[model samples]
Target chain A: MTMATVQTPPKISAQGVNVFYGDTHAVDNVSLDLYQDEVTALIGPSGCGKSTFLRCLNRMNDTIADCRVSGQILLDDEDIYASQIDVVQLRARVGMVFQKPNPFPKSIYDNVAYGPRIHGLADTREDLDEIVAVSLEKAGLWDEVKDRLDHLGTTLSGGQQQRLCIARAIAIDPEVILMDEPCSALDPIATAKVEALIEELKGGYAIILVTHSMQQAARISQKTAFFHLGQLIEFGDTTQIFTSPTSGRTRDYITGRLV
Target chain B: MTSLPNLKKRWGRPQVQRRLRRRYIYERIFRMLGLAAIGVAGLALATLIVSVGKNAFGGFVQTSIDVDIYLNPEDLRPSSARYRHDFAERVESADMRKLLADALERQFPDIDTDSERRRALQLFSLQARRTLRDYITATPEKIGQTVRMRLLASDDVDQVVKGNIDPRVPESDRRVKDKELAWLAALRADGRISRQLSTTFFTGGDSREPEIAGIFGAIIGSVLTLLVTLLTAFPIGTLAAIYLEEFSPQNRLTAFIEVNINNLAAVPSIVFGLLGLSLFLSILELPRSSPLVGGLTLALMTLPTIIIASRASLRAVPQGLRTAAQGLGASPMQVVFHHVVPSAMPGILTGTIIGLSRGLGETAPLLMIGMVAFVVSTPNALTDAATVLPVQIFLWADSPERAFVEKTSAAILVLLGFLLAVNALAVWLRQRFEVHIPD
Candidate 1:
């Protein structure tokens, strides 16, 4: 839309990346650029590795012992898998929200305070309190939950709990937030609320979202990436990816012809 | 109608004749026999309770004589009121019968005037006077009053009043000999030999006479055993479970350890006693019959139960919770301790309580470790030779006297009551500590 927007280096770059679960090559080599300060959506059929590629950005697949990853994943022009980089430290910079909302069995305040406490970002009780308040406010859940700060995080409704989890992740002040289908578990209203929160989140943090709903991807994301058989079939601005695509797979998927 | 039609339409064999019904007569017989066996086992439990109840309830009733023992407060009272506490301690003490004898003689010209009828004093629980004396001594100001205290007579008196004694028995065969019975009748005419319920069963200690020993010492010993068991078992069990379940690598050595744990849980508790005997008693030369050694043996037996329970609790914490913690950049150990561990606490407590209940009635193991029959002035320390409720019951059951039979039954009742109370406490704690864990 503007010359300044076209000038920024990608926040993350994936080139010929492949993911294997033992002998099963679940994700094929694919290349894409995820930019900072934008909602980049990944959508495909089930098992198309859309979520798998999102997981690769933060090295979340390292948890599964049998999962093997290949090719280069770069963050800010350097390979992220360099021997000196610790995954724990990397994860702190890149937070995650899973498909199902999993809130901790702790109070609302503690849930928000957990990330800051773990990362040693806040030293005093007052500092921790301020971080929780700010994080919850960013997630747009503070006003609804401020009165019940002592209530267990798990005791919230599905939508509130998901938002609380997002707030908990963001409290660490991560540079990029990876959300794996964060709204697939919610109703339409809750989904809209999450999309709005993502739009708001994009100003300060780069967001990589995976979703099965094509309309959802088109609605909020600035950039869109379509994956098929673990390959990045297409990547472009959301309007171009939705209305006009360079690849046949992307065209078929957008037209509801390809699974 | 369908079967008949099928038979008529059958091309090869008649359908009704070819069909095989599900039940075989032989199989039916076996099934009936199995069910019958299960029913018999279930009924046997009730039978044991009834039989044990019949024997133990006999101890709560006592034979007593309304002894009019006069007291000399000046003789017992020192310059200060401090010794007055010792007065009750002396009166309701295990040796209260002797103390009452001395006090009566101090004030009366002929206190031994009724030594002949003293044999008839068996109608009262002797523990009652010891209790009264102890109470008055605790509050020494009440020592001079001529209060008509309803002192307990004796266990033999309890049996006769409860109608447990057979009237047809000969004098030579009965502790309540014919001559003693005649003396009891004479006192009864004077309204001096009245039977009353005994609470001394809860306050006194063991002796050769069934009429004297109370469960006070055993209760203290059992409580101390539990305290020791908890102290040793809890942290050790919880740490072991956390290491095995959350941190340790999966390998043959770990698998072997896991197998051993399950096996250890099934090992006869007596083996733990024998191990304790060799290691704690014989080699270490700790005092035999100490609650310390007994507690250690029980602790060893309880550890496996607690570990298994703790592991189960840890496993019950949903994987989602751990993922949530990790996604927030929490360390793996933090994920386990901060999120998972607290949710599992209720289960751990329940398991510990159950382990305690099992340890409470463990007589065979305790006996092997020498907590069965040593006499003590008091439970002065953990290593002192002490008796527990089950051990007391075991000893009472083995005694040659018939009076002890009733004592044995009463001890059984007390042990069961302790179990009930402990279980209730566990349930209360579980409910209070319950996390947001789903059913």
Candidate 2:
């Protein structure tokens, strides 16, 4: 980590956040800071609350009937869970890409333009079109899909659909992008392409990713948080965490010994 | 517990082979039972269709005899000197029955006694008098001309022509007398008797006489009733489903409402009719036997079905899609209306159509709403007195007239045709609007 990068204030700060799904404490007390122009990877075993914590950032947990979220999550120092904050507007500034490729059952162009159209970010048809084209390009999919923009989003291959979802998240021009295992459903080649796209997108927005693959966290993220059984075990630079994890559980997880 | 090698060897054993053969035998027997069940069902349906078809064929064709009637101006003129200035009254009081009797006498000169003359006139339908009068009224210049017109045969004569009545039956046992049969034979031999499609059955309204009774009024009534049902039930049911599935919080009250809705779907349709009888007929005092009341009654019956189906389809929409839309900052209403509803529309439409089809065949509820009345005119509006096809079939099926047997069957076929058309439309709409999504 460079001294200059460490000097910048965090773009988003979670202070003592917790999530409960009905009677189950899914995400225990966890505090983390995500800086602009950096990729923060949350790595954990299955059922370790990595995805649950990722959902808390944009208040996606509000959709669950029995899931309750507590503690303050501030985006650029403004409390996101404040009663005055509109969840819809909060989500517009914080977008998400899901674990699986979930493109709307609509045309490819509409899929990419969904967010911008919903938020009224584009003033004209040409502007919306330009936004869709640029988002798709930024997701590394414009060249493959430029000619057939009207095709159904679902008709695309699994990898292309993921890219389309990423483009959808990017279309609204969010300040923070949260990804939950975005490449888990793709092949190795598609994963590489997505990883490359993430590398190019790191400096433009604060990215928080939940991944099961430690190698993926080490390769694509600047900071890494290790979660074990709904609790954050360690948080530090990705290289240091991989080389010398402070917590024994984190070291066990890094060595593929703790399931 | 066997080792792998031992298990592999066991696969080649004779006992294992016998067990495998037994399993195959069981599978074959299950397949045969399934086929037998299907064949039985198919045979039952075929028997129903064939019997109904055989009985209905006679209802579509009518026997008629061409008669040259000498329209005398003196007979048409009113004999009342007190009403000398009324031309319309002159036309209204025309002796049409006498005119038709004279025409039949002219066609058959062998009739001397009043009894024979009466039997001869019985060969023509009672409506033949009205038909002749209407013709003369429509073209008054033909009042003095000998116009040749084909007149409808009575129900007995029609049955005789269709070979439904056996000539060997005694005169005391049959409606048609031997003498009338002989006159009909003569008419047939003279090339005056013709069997043609019964346009009256498709064009005219209900009547006491089977020959002139038609289903047109009933068809219009059914259509109007179903339209009312669709218009009232679809939007209300769909919106209710959206509210329950998307917006309502998960609580005991909503759960109770859901259970009640499901129970409502299972309630007997006749119960809805009784409710309509009290609520719409007795209390509200809407027109009796009107399609408006009947449709409202059916809409009540259809609402629960549509709600259940709509909610089921809405629930079937992938949660991932909802999450995706929400992630893009779409409101709850927007998520449901734009994505969930569109994806579930085909299913909702299919359910609505199925409900409507069920409404089409419903009889008891409509009967309770006074739709069982013998309506004679085609209903022009929702408030007009009307009877639906099933009620028409019911009325015909209960008549003492033998000709009504075929009319009943024919009405059944028309009702079935309507149901088939509705279900086919449902299929077409489902296919046209279904959103294709990979699992």
Candidate 3:
């Protein structure tokens, strides 16, 4: 709350957003603000709607056949769900990394260059190469994969592929990056690498991370929101939320008693 | 009553051991049945190949008699000025059969009577005349020269040489008469009658005479028809599949369409023939008995197979790829075309090839469109009257001539070779282009 009081205008603001999959209210009314130059983590147990709420920011939930969203999610104060808004354009501005390190079955260069190529972010081959290099450099994968740029992206290890996904997301210069458990499939060493990469990438983009690990949110995120059973229990600075949660559910969850 | 010690006591009982033994027996029975099923399938396939090969061996080699005949200038008249501009016409009109009859008379000079000499001439095939005509036309300067040529023996002679017409079988029951067999023996003793590779069987068109009947024309017809089918069915089926699986909304209409497509695959191929008879031949007024109509009819029959296979393969592409593409701001169309379709391409090609191979072996459909006609000349165009390999096989199979039995088996082998090649190509394509999507 102290960090929220001193912040500039929120980069992305969700106001009473609700999501329904058929008859199930997957994401109940939840309001939160994500600020630029900071990592905000959404931490919850499984089926708590943290991932669903994260997908709503860029309308990724729209791809689901029976899923419906109500209320407003605004990026830079512009409603993303309005009919006039192009979902393609909205997604270009807000990229995503998935849980399973799903890289396109393409060469490392093409995998990083895909978003740029489709969005026409690069004017020439040289520009594209430079963009791929810089994106890989930023994702902390350039040193490992620069020589084998022509190798298929999936041939990389789990951690490297996850980093490649991050590079793919950032290649388009997306303003907001959403990660859904990007390290859950990785070993502890790979997870540590990704955590370090996130630390290095924190101030450059508004990162909204949905993670099962509360310690990951505490270690890397500047702000944290705890969700339980499709409702946000509390939101605050990372230290305050971890040490002294205002909600009883948040305290129980933090103490490993909520299950 | 159900304490831990009671459960242990029940486990030690003879009933439990009996149930375990019964389970083992059931497992053994299931495994034995599986092995028996495989053995039956293998035995059936082996029997089919062996029988077909045995029957077809006669069709691949032809019996011929080497004859040296003096080409008389009076008969050929190659020196005529009227035939100077059209030498082929002279060769065509020339009485090559008379020359063959004269050559046979020279080979069997002992046969002095007119009826015996005529019977000796009957041992040579009518193709022998064409063989002389082609050679004399190609080398017109050799007129009046004694040329040693190998000429085709009659189908009966060919059958006797190949052991299809058993000499020991009563002469009344067989096509080769005893007198003809004696002449064949004389020719064989003279080292004039010999068996060589049958070039005519591979190069010539169909004929009423099985000696000159070949599958070349049928192969051409099949190639052209399959070309048309592939060109029509592949894109249409693949695009339709992409639309249904990717773009089409999950509504009752699309569901109904899906049901129809699945049902169409099971519809008897003859039903497609009838449809082609009414639609393409009757309503569209396309040329009957032509490759064009045959191909269109087959396309109709093959569309459901291609569509069903393509849809299944398209479905096999991981949903994660689509989500990843869409998450990168790709439009719905872009998501499918860029990532999904490319990943599914190997599977689509395999399906398309399998469908085409099925169409290749299809007969009843082509039969309905009048492709069962007796076309002697090779077709020069899509609209020309042409019969496919299966229809040719069907025609030869129906003939009363004993020589045609081997020809039928040979044609079947050719068709099977084509199918095997196509399936091998499908397997190669799948291996070559399959994108490994890690789970």
What is the C-alpha DockQ of each candidate? 0.47, 0.85, 0.80
TM-score of each: 0.82, 0.96, 0.95
lDDT of 1 by residue, B264-378 (tens): 9999988998998998988998888888888888999999999999999988888888777777777778878898888888988988888889999898889888788745335
- The most accurate candidate by lDDT is 2
lDDT of 2 by residue, B236-290 (tens): 9999999999999989999999999999999999999999999998999999999
- TM-score pick, better of 1 and 3: 3
DockQ of 1: 0.47
lDDT of 2 at B408: 90
Two-way DockQ contest, 1 vs 3, winner: 3
The runs of at least 3 residues in candidate 3 whose Cα sits more than 4 Å from the true structure, single-residue gaps closed, are A1-5, B1-25, B73-93, B110-114, B140-145
Which of the numbered candidates is closest to the native, going by highest DockQ? 2
Candidate 1's TM-score: 0.82
Residue B326 shift from truth in candidate 1, angstroms: 0.5
lDDT of 3 by residue, A27-122 (tens): 899999989888999998899999999999988898889999998888999999999999999999999999998899999999999999999999
Across residues B1-439, which tens digit of lDDT does each residue of candidate 3 receive?
A: 7646678779899999999999999999999999999999999999999999999888888889888988988887754555655778877877887787788777777777888877877788888887788899889899988899988888888888888777888889877788888878988898988888888888888999999999999999999999989999998999999999998999999999999999999999999999999999899999999999999899999999999999999999988898888889999988998899999989899889989999999999998999999998788899999988999999999999889999999999999999999999999999888888875
DockQ of 2: 0.85
Docking quality level of the chain pair in candidate 1: acceptable
Model 2 agreement with the true structure over A1-259: per-residue lDDT tens digits: 6566788889999999999999999989999989999999999899999999999999999888899999889999999999999999988999999999999999999999888887888999999999999999999999999999999999999999999999999999999999999999999999999999998999889999999888799999999999988899999999999999899999998898999
Candidate 2 residue B419 C-alpha distance from true site, Å: 1.0
Instruction: Report the candidate with higher TM-score, 1 versus 2.
Output: 2
* C-alpha lDDT (0 to 100) for residue B237 of candidate 3: 94
